[model samples]
Target chain A: MKTLLDLLMLSCKKASELIDKQLLLNLSLKERLMLKIHTRLCEACFEYEKQSKLLDKLLLKHISTSEESQIPIQINIELKQKIIHNINPKK
Target chain B: MLNEMDTNNPATTITSWVKLYSDNLFSWALHKTSDREIAEDLVQDTFLVAVNSFDKFEGKSNPKSWLFAILNNKINDHYRSNFRHQTTNNTISLDEYFDANEHWRPEETPQPWLVESSHILDNPEFTKQFEECMQRLPQHWFSAIHLKYIEERKGVAICQEIGITPTNFWQILHRAKLQLRKCLETHWFKI
Candidate 1:
């Protein structure tokens, strides 16, 4: 018979796992049952799990949409020239 | 991730490698320090370090990883150099907050502050407040929180990168969270 405090800690740990959706999806039946029980009794853990899920979604969205521009042609040429000059000073 | 093309020409090989890795190295340093100018300097320093040690690279790993390994060392060196000059708050013991025996026990199950995604992005005030709260944190706690939450690095990776044991990593993370929670509740939470 786990105390409410013990149950709460377990729920907190599971809430953190919500950040990784793959882990969330892979939760064992027993773990799912435990989460269900904990969320029903613990509003804080429930809210934490929800917020963690939202945060993960937002972060992934930000990362995926970010574009990396290619280096400018002039800058690349200059860099190449500089390297060539360094390697062969007489040129 | 290596851009190794015809290493027979040392000059061309070095130039290609620098061009290929410059963005990645800068990004890595920027993430670590959250400063663009500092990141650029660090990346430049990394290239110099890499050139001097090119003979030691031995093709054991991808060039990107190798560059990153050097960049990480550079970042650590920067931290070490500035650590002596930095002031840290000594009022509270972050260690006590993370004791496994006294784990996080929020007074009441905190209700999630319901803010839509668009609202979060649009509200400059919210962002400012959050940044302020983050600035108040101790350096180690701030680094741990940023690495864990913002960068989304794993505990094991953080442990390896920071050269701390897993237990210490957890403790640091726990302390950071506890401090952040407290800060948000006290300053940012209007309701």
Candidate 2:
């Protein structure tokens, strides 16, 4: 007794959630169809999916780039001394 | 270095390992978590556990890998405990984004963000802004996003390790991304 509207209609809120879900897992056939329908009818959700994907892409790139550059971190000499002291005790 | 070192002396052996590995572990922990204090604490805890299990860990795995595995477990526990300890204060209402009918509110609706610069993330200032926005996220949400994007971990793997349901994971990501999107728009794009 499921109608096409019932199967395919999703509010932007739900559609956005499905968009995020699709990133981590494949949406069900109904979920996919509903997402497709909703994004078609909703420009905001369409922009949202695009922006969300872009954000992930940028964040990933930033992470790798920052790591490669090493963020100019100074080795924590104090923490090192502390660890050595803690582990060597009563040995 | 290890061949000449005294394996019988736990103190000397662990001290050498600490001197070698602590810096690498700290940088990694810092990357995974942007907090310096937490990163240092995790490294401290990782070594403490390593000392307790040093005999058990003997001759089984490479020291580097063994230490990393322990650190990873600590990181997972960090995420799990943060998620478990979360109260209503940690959650932001979904009503801010959607209307009573569950459609996007006019003000909260997503807008196109022009990402024309392929080298966008290369900009030092933008990267700073990005990190700041990520810092605004709840601890659990930040961990989820970090696992998914920075570590490129699988959803199922993250859910299994972090002990959160897939449905809840997606919902958190949805909300997290919305905040990120809005933050970047206001700070980077609009600027």
Candidate 3:
């Protein structure tokens, strides 16, 4: 017989892993149902789900704009010539 | 200025590739490697390889992807070589997160984070902390996550580019996300 915790609990680690994995691929129906059940009963898992969703959103925005926040490193003419030279020593 | 015909002319366009593609490539390389010199070298090497292999030019894909493919190879080779030197701490024992019977530990339990954490991206301090946390990750793990979340590459493509199987990719991503969440909690969220 399955214990109460087995039916009710989603370990924090497994919940977090499933959260990250969903970003890469879809979770199975059983996995999704288990997560839904666990999050309803487990406050911690619920919070983790919220935070991870927010994290994915923030990460997407941060990465897209990260370059804009800084002055980009310039490749000067000298370096251009040096690169060309390295690529074509004959020239 | 680059017509389809001109792109095929290695003599004319290849040298000028530096002017056209170097800055963008350099920025991408810098973002991936996080070291200026290595980034610069990778960009140079990419162009060098392109020039040397100009005979085999097949312009089926756009120039950007072709160049990025070369740069990705350079990045892959780099982290693989560095892999042997660095001792990566990827062995995150699940025992710490759960009890023997697999319940969350009392002290280690997750708490409700702010609902408006998406707004945290607006805070410069939090962004700095996020970047610092990212830097602390193992190189391969960082590269994989960066490609997934930042570059927005698909999972299969990222796995192929990074030379890992899909299973390994997921495992790396799991450990990386776990560490990242912990880092953010301490530095930004502060439960």
Candidate 4:
């Protein structure tokens, strides 16, 4: 039998899409309500929301420190010499 | 080539710029690409392009930013070319995680991670695993997330840079996060 919860329910796929979209954009009233109902009834979506948030925090910190402010790598002297030679053959 | 090493042209000389900027550029390229040979080639290519267009530099923008702009283009080109050649099997399907009724499969349900696992973000081992997992993602997905969260760019800026529409950006972010979460669970949380 069709019920209100069943009518409002979103599939895991749709619920997850809304979850991702929520990070970038605001959900409408219906989307928010449907997703909320889906998550409450669906354990997987609940855990996905938690893990997604955790990933954002951890990845932001991890990539900022590691990729943005990296420990300086030693440049290959030979490579530098080769580049200079190629750029200005006379020099 | 004519000698351009006069004091008046100090900043523009190939030798002077190499001594000053090569180390910084090389290190940056090496870090972003994670391959020594490719990084070296990119740096070389950047300099060659810069030398070709030295006349257009105009001394308006800072040399570092101009050089970085060139390097960024080179990186984008490499990724675009690589993406075209890569196989399509890496794409994730929503159907794999959900049933026809739109519910998650039992195997697809996520287990609760340790509450304190967020602290592992600072750990070196976890960072390595995170980086590996990120690298495993399709190039475009990695680029989108990298520009959005890692670079902290605005949504519009990310879409502009990636040449994706706003809606497409959100979809990519959603799928990328899903893949990242699953990868992290296997490699880091394990709970």
Worst 10 residues of 4 chain B by lDDT: B1-10
Clash pairs, model 2 backbone: none
Q: What tens-digit string does per-residue lDDT give for candidate 4 at B1-191?
A: 23444434533475677877788888887766666887898888999888877777766677777887898788666654453344244455677667887777776677788766667766666767877888888766776665666555557665665455677678778888878887887877784
Question: Among all windows of ten consecutive residues in candidate 1 chain B, which has the lowest summed lDDT?
Answer: B83-92
lDDT of 3 by residue, B1-191 (tens): 33733645574666666777778788777766677788888888888788777666666667667787888788766765554344255455667567886676786666666546456766767777877888887776776665666556678776676556666667777777667777888776674
Q: What is the lDDT of residue B28 in candidate 4?
A: 82
- The ten-residue window of minimal lDDT in model 2 chain B covers B83-92
Residue B84, candidate 1: how far off, in angstroms?
Answer: 15
Query: In lDDT terms, which candidate is top?
Result: 2
lDDT of 4 by residue, A6-86 (tens): 799888889888988876678999999998998898888899988887877876775544553464657689987898788
Residues forming the 10-long window of minimal summed lDDT in candidate 3 chain B: B83-92
Better DockQ candidate (2, 4): 4
lDDT of 1 by residue, A1-91 (tens): 9886565445354443332323213556666666667667667667656654554444333322222232111233443344435544466
Interface RMSD of each: 7.5, 2.8, 3.7, 2.9
Highest-TM-score candidate? 2
* Order by lDDT, highest first: 2, 4, 3, 1
Q: Which ten residues in a row have the lowest lDDT in candidate 4 chain A?
A: A62-71
CAPRI class of candidate 1: incorrect
Give the runs in model 1 whose Cα sits over 4 Å from its true position: A1-32, A54-91, B1-109, B149-154, B161-168, B189-191
Each candidate structure's TM-score, on Cα atoms with residue i matched to residue i, is 0.47, 0.80, 0.68, 0.76
- Scored against the true structure, residue B22 in model 3 reaches a CA lDDT of 78
Model 3 Cα RMSD, Å? 5.1
Model-by-model lDDT, in order? 0.54, 0.79, 0.70, 0.74
